[model samples]
Target: MSLLVAWQLKDRRVLIVGGGEIASQRMDSILVTDASIAVIAPEHRLNSRARQLIACHHARITHHDRLFLGPSELHNIDMVLTALDDPERSREIVLMCRDARIPVNAADIPDLCDFYFGAQIRDGPLQIMISTNGNGPRLASRIKERLQRALSGGEGEAITKVGRLRTLLKQKAPGIGGDQGRRRMKWMTRLCNEWELEDFAQLDNAMMKSLLEDGWEKDRIPSLQDVGGTCSTRRYHQNFHSTIPLAVGFFVGVFTTALITFFRHRK
Candidate 1:
């Protein structure tokens, strides 16, 4: 299985080796991050949208209006994306990237890709990425659509509130080691588990700030039980039950050890 991770691309340099629709789409995706982008393709070959995007980010993006040279151009680049129509040119770029130790995503050719750009659902600090191990992009897109719909109602606001709460806790709690850090982590995790989008949607910034300042009093915190059965509680219980066999085995091992110790003392 391929290990998935989120790469930090802020202020990093990325190279795009095509200027067509696929290249434009890839450019759009990378633009969301604070990466310096360079597009190397013939000036007249780029689509209008691609041209516009490049012009819009002229300060951060540099357009080379020519075909890619040898591996010399790969120096100092963190990643490369080749959306070239020519399979031979794409392969050449991939080989050069591999030699330079740079990760690459060659559009439409899974075998040449070091990574796949999966469909993503982003909502104000909350992001969910869906991938199908390079087997089904369309299926991933469909799943992303369903997830987007399910997460649409007031979730953005909820995530914003949670983010604010976390910042407040960090400022108040300060260090994240030893007893203080563990306490803070426990408090935050419990709050996240119990709270839902509906609960945060009704809360104003002032109230939330007050809750933070007051150390999350029992009366101040909203109870999921009052609003009917909580899905979070059900999920927690389900997880607990699933681990019962392991828990039983652990207890049995401890009991057997204690019994052997008692018999040795008697002898």
Candidate 2:
């Protein structure tokens, strides 16, 4: 780990050196970055959705329709993503980017890449990064799917709340670290869990403000046991009627079958 690699393409120019399906996939990732993109390819082959994206979005991709990597093509490019089917062309693009000190991502070729795109889940200001370390993309994708199931939609909002609370704690409880900091964070996290804020988005700003102001004090912490007990009681009561109706229906069906069988035997 001698290298601590980081690249900033925010609001910068992104050049892609291919136009096939592989290049189209890379285009999707770069689009999210809001980077000004230009794709240079000799031909065009894309799905309907992909074609729509390139056409409607700010992606400034222009197909070369010619097999050549001219020096003029590198004009004002900050980053390059090479996804050409030909390894030799990809290698050449990497070399050009290296000489120019521009960041390059070569798909399916770790040796030629400056950065590897990982499975990323963005929840507002919260980001969960999952990387396979260039070993197994299938495993990375599997983990990403699980994370999506667990943390997408409302999950992101919950995490954002946690982050805001942590920031507030750090600012409010200065110099508190080790056991004290851990205890404070643990308690705040537990409060979130107990509240199940996923279902309670209407928590007033005043209450959130108060929580941030007084979250460090143990006395201010809400009773988790009482909250959980109430939730459980409510669930049981709500489902009790539904359960009874289903049970009665099942028994009636069984009894009717039994009666039919007995009458058939008598006859």
Best by TM-score: 1
- The segments of candidate 2 whose C-alpha lies over 4 angstroms from its true place after superposition are 1-7, 42-47, 59-68, 146-153, 160-267
Look at candidate 1 and tell me the lDDT of residue 92: 88
Candidate 1: residue 45 Cα off by (Å): 1.1
Model 2, C-alpha of 54: deviation from truth (Å): 1.5
Q: Of the candidates shown, which would achieve the greatest lDDT relative to the real structure?
A: 1
Cα lDDT tens digits, model 2, 75-192, are: 7989888876788888887888888888888887888887787777776755667887867788988999997865426655656666666666777666667876777767776776
Residue pairs in steric clash, candidate 2?
A: none
For candidate 2, the lDDT comes to: 0.68
Which ranges in model 1 have alpha carbons more than 4 Å from their true place?
A: 201-204, 216-267
